[model samples]
Target: MLRFLEVFAKGSQIHVPVGSPLIRKIPIFVDEHDVTAGAMKLIKVLRPAWDTSDVKTKLFTDGTTNKLVGCYVEDSPEDVVLVRVYGHKTELIVDRDNELKSFQVLHANGCAPRLYCTFLNGICYEFMQGDALGTQDVRDPSLRRLIAGEMARIHAIHAHNGCIPKPNLWIKMRRYFSLVATEFTDQASNVRIQQEVPSKAVLEQEMAWMKEHLSTLGSPVVLCHNDLLCKNIIHNEKDGHVRFIDYEYSSYNYQAFDIGNHFNEFAGMAELDYGLYPSREMQMDWLRVYLQAYKLFSQKGEEVSARELETLYVQVNKFALASHFFWGFWALIQAKYSTIDFDFLGYAVLRFNRYFETKPAAMALQIPQ
Candidate 1:
């Protein structure tokens, strides 16, 4: 129980005992007016505690300005509600509305936590009293199938509604890539990054070429959880089902990119364990099962042909290039402004190296021109 008190554990952040009576007085540190209002409303729904009851707000600090408040009421001490105060880093502009809506949609489908309310800069949602999936959990054959099935289910969801704008992945990448000149720092790292990875001019050319070819790929474009890092998959130990959190990167994109990014995740979790990266055969095996699940979920699509499957296999391998490049630039931008202790520049180099590493494999495939 004490071990779960920390935000991230060694391999995984396991479930914590939330409802137990071994209560302690944690500080009710809150500043944002919207957060307070959101928390009070959640409290009201939990019980009639405004009249007379002890209320406590527990804080979860992760070194970022974003405020995470756990609202606990006297009547329902066990039922904890988390208030996510959206403190947007000026450098990173995520659509708060899109993120909230994505969360709600996934929650409705039982793919994410139950969202409660949205305010000025944040939203309150159900906190999963569970553990994060470990590196092995993601690599195991059976578990990988289960996760693939879950991703298939997510992709089946319609991204844009009547007025909601669909995500423009090309524009998004262009926007991220635009920051390279201004964001990348550390002359030594810049020199190393330049020598090891594609130069900005080369990347722009590659991106243009990739975009032209990928748009014509046979696979259907569906809602993609673009970032499938291992840390984001939450496993409910009680039932063996996993729910994905962090909707900031979820958007409408090519199915291949989503699957490729996930396969890319198999390369490593916290650190680069390229040795753990899946073999081509293993990736294809998972893709087949994923397609089966996708077939079941997508009612309108015709049965996948062997040729379609082969195309997808090749396309996924190629899209792997885009995934690495996407994150490589992302790491460079994050390295510029992020306050976290992790070495963003070094991580940027790693992602860039992965981009180069995957390029040859993509070249070998007879993908769409």
Candidate 2:
């Protein structure tokens, strides 16, 4: 084990033993709240040399599928370490490869954290030291403009042909709905409808709409950070620069998708329960900033007219509805098969209701060809 540990001296190997009592028993200093025993064990095996007496691990709160944990080795100055652990498997190996590639691309474009090293099973990057911009921070006009500018710059970078292929939106939507339907059928008795989950017939109609629209929508391929939630954006006070983290869902897609997705985050769709949805006026203001920045930074310099912007806005809502349905179904399934308690079906139904209520005006905004 010690011999194997030597190869990990730089903290770049992934196959190190994790969860073993022997691994846990290894004497190492760590911050109480920064990491789990499993994370620590992995860190110890691939120990990166630092002048600090001990290392601290701070688990970030923004993860769904994979555990996103940060390790900070405090020498005279603190340095950040980001570790993404996908469970042990061949799939994890592929994930690590993609993550490393994405990290490199983002770093080269000056959009993300500096890559330190990657283990075949996980990834580590130099920690980004800054305050994460919140809803309030994003509300500032200057800050919003800056963020918009950065996002445009990121999208301007050209991706290799099919390097990040776009997924067929309708196919993906059907898969999402199927997952939900399976869950609903299995737990029919437990499912409670808050706003009425869309009937299979209605869902099929929506899916058909997505398929038709997707085909008509021109492909404006660009490198996109598809998941640009506000939390993924970090602001460095020292340099007054904003950095993006998390590129797991990046791909080549329509520029409108990226534009609309970021706008959705600014719209505060995720925190609708908190009554944080932006006013129509506010939404327009954000759109203006985003479009201005996008035009300035995009290599194509394509001017997006107000009509086109509005149409894309409506399309984004459609995408959001699809996502809500998918998650709703996924949650329903998990609740059925696993020991988790949450009203996913109810939430999905609520989102569906909200979509219908807002869809008319949003659709009205679409540019008539």
Give the alpha-carbon lDDT of every model.
0.67, 0.57
Compared to the true structure, candidate 2 yields what TM-score? 0.72
Q: State the displacement of the C-alpha of residue 41, model 2, in Å, after optimal TM-score superposition.
A: 3.6
For model 2, how does the per-residue alpha-carbon lDDT over 318-354 read when each residue is reduced to its tens digit?
4554444444454444434432234445545655666
Mind giving the per-residue lDDT tens digits that candidate 1 earns over 100-208?
A: 5567667666787766655445566778766666667888777788788899898877544423333356766888888675433345455656565566677888889
Which regions of candidate 2 fall more than 4 Å away from where they truly are? Answer: 1-35, 45-47, 51-53, 87-100, 117-121, 162-168, 186-190, 193-196, 214-219, 267-271, 301-347
Please report the candidate that would top lDDT against the real structure.
Answer: 1
> Candidate 2: what lDDT?
0.57
Q: Assess the local accuracy of residue 171 in candidate 2 as a C-alpha lDDT between 0 and 100.
A: 42
What are the TM-scores, per candidate, against the unseen true structure? 0.76, 0.72
